[model samples]
Target: MSTIGSEGWTLVHQARQKHYDDRYYGHWLGTRDDGQWIIGRLYPGKSMDDGFRDGEWAYSKRFAGDPSTDNADAALTAYVEMAHNTFVWDRVFDQTVGEAIDLYWAGPEVPDAPKLAAGWAGAESPNPDRVVSSAGCSIAMPLHEAKFLLLHYLRRTELAAKAHLTKGVTVDRHGAVEKVRCATGPIRFEYGYNTYWLT
Candidate 1:
């Protein structure tokens, strides 16, 4: 029995704007094929009037039969998880401290794969209450803040790898970006643009 529609999808869940600071991002759960479900996230539109939008499948899974609510819920969680792990520069302004953070995980040294701790790089220690056993986080912040946050962690000798910052960026917010700044060294930014015109 094919649950998916002719368009190739069946909507199961939709994100509640109340849960996301009233920002209308589309985090939807559905099935593109029978027995296979996915979480699709529509990137926020431009000024709410952008004729077209873009999106991606953040997570997907196949089931023995049709997936249960529990499975759908897990996929929704993955939707949020993917959002927390992706730092879309322009979208950072809508994220809060809780949503924007970095997590440090134990490397191969610990066979059990324990998540050592979670916190942003700006602090001297990981947040005491936010300890996670198997999770990770990602977000964007100013270059100086990133430096202060990662410098100590990078110098740690116990970890199997060195920590480094990605994307040298500094943002200003006064209703909108008032200024644009970059780190002192060589800098690069990856940009992709998508737009559609209404007929």
Candidate 2:
């Protein structure tokens, strides 16, 4: 496990062929598509401060996209900053990542809920240092995030996002994106939350 940024967030990574039975051994965390710099977090809920909970990998929301920069380090910086910025810090962190995750998760702290975007449409924020917010309440992304998500969805075969997308399906004036249609389905502005689709 490598450390990310100046922040205490750990980078949990393993090769595709590498798998361990150990619980803390880690999984395929996320990816930074080089060149296009499509940055995305595979696990939305994973908390940098809490490590892993019970059977959970993450508990936060963030986004993805194409190569925004040619530099790997700069691209990485963008991804981590976005993740740290967009989640409710008080929920998992009463203190900070410098403390222990196990203690944080087992404590008597109240669960901090994610806020709804203005107009009650989508997601709003996280408190670390947000890079960008996308898809209203869905997820946040880096520079090339939009293009990345569009391509990511389009690459799939299950949904015909290219054909079904219509204004009637997207987020209304209130900001809530209910049932929209697309080829790649809903593009996650954040990991677990679906915000935008190809229209």
Candidate 3:
């Protein structure tokens, strides 16, 4: 059973906040039978409130027209792909972290150890020394290399979590490129150590 209630209106409001106006509006209307329930004009750059009643009406009309058409399913799919692209992940780290790491170590090839180590001074440190050591092929590499390697591992963990939450997508370790894609496209990353040692 499908019903377009206040929740649907809430989603419409949310969509309007994201700048998706009328042209993108119809997709959100739930199915209705008589089509009378579908209200509102598809105006460009209109407020979500302006279209709320109409959108609800349209949904009701679609449902009235054919209850078995799976209108809710279609609407939900569109919402996930378009209206909620980032819903699967949260912003756990500051934007500067990504920027600093990219500026220092991002390139077509892996950077040299010393240069990579220099970038980790103020970044978030990876957990578990064993994971860090395993990632960098033994901790002999410069601090930066270990950090870079750790960042790569953390990114993989985040990607896996996102895929699991959104669309039940799972990327195998063998398919590294595919895994990266699931991380919402490529961006620069950095690795940092928990503490520095001085002689």
- Can you give the TM-score per candidate against the true fold? 0.26, 0.17, 0.21
2 versus 3: better lDDT goes to: 3
Give the CA lDDT, 0 to 100, for residue 177 in model 1.
9
Candidate 3 lDDT over 30-105, as tens digits, reads 3233321222223333444454454343322222233322333343334334333322212432232333332222
Q: Candidate 1: give the clashing pairs.
A: 121-149
RMSD of every prediction: 19.9, 17.9, 17.7
Stretches of model 1 off by over 4 angstroms after superposition? 1-7, 16-24, 47-73, 82-199
lDDT (tens digit, per residue) of candidate 2 on 1-199: 3434332343433211111332222122232322222233333322333343432343332233422222332433454444444332234332222122212111232234222111111233233453233322225333133333333332231132222233454333112211211112223332222234422
Candidate 1 per-residue lDDT, tens place, 159-199, comes to 22211121122211110001111122222221111010100
Q: lDDT for each of the candidates?
A: 0.31, 0.29, 0.31
User: What's the distance in Å from true for residue 181, model 2?
Assistant: 17
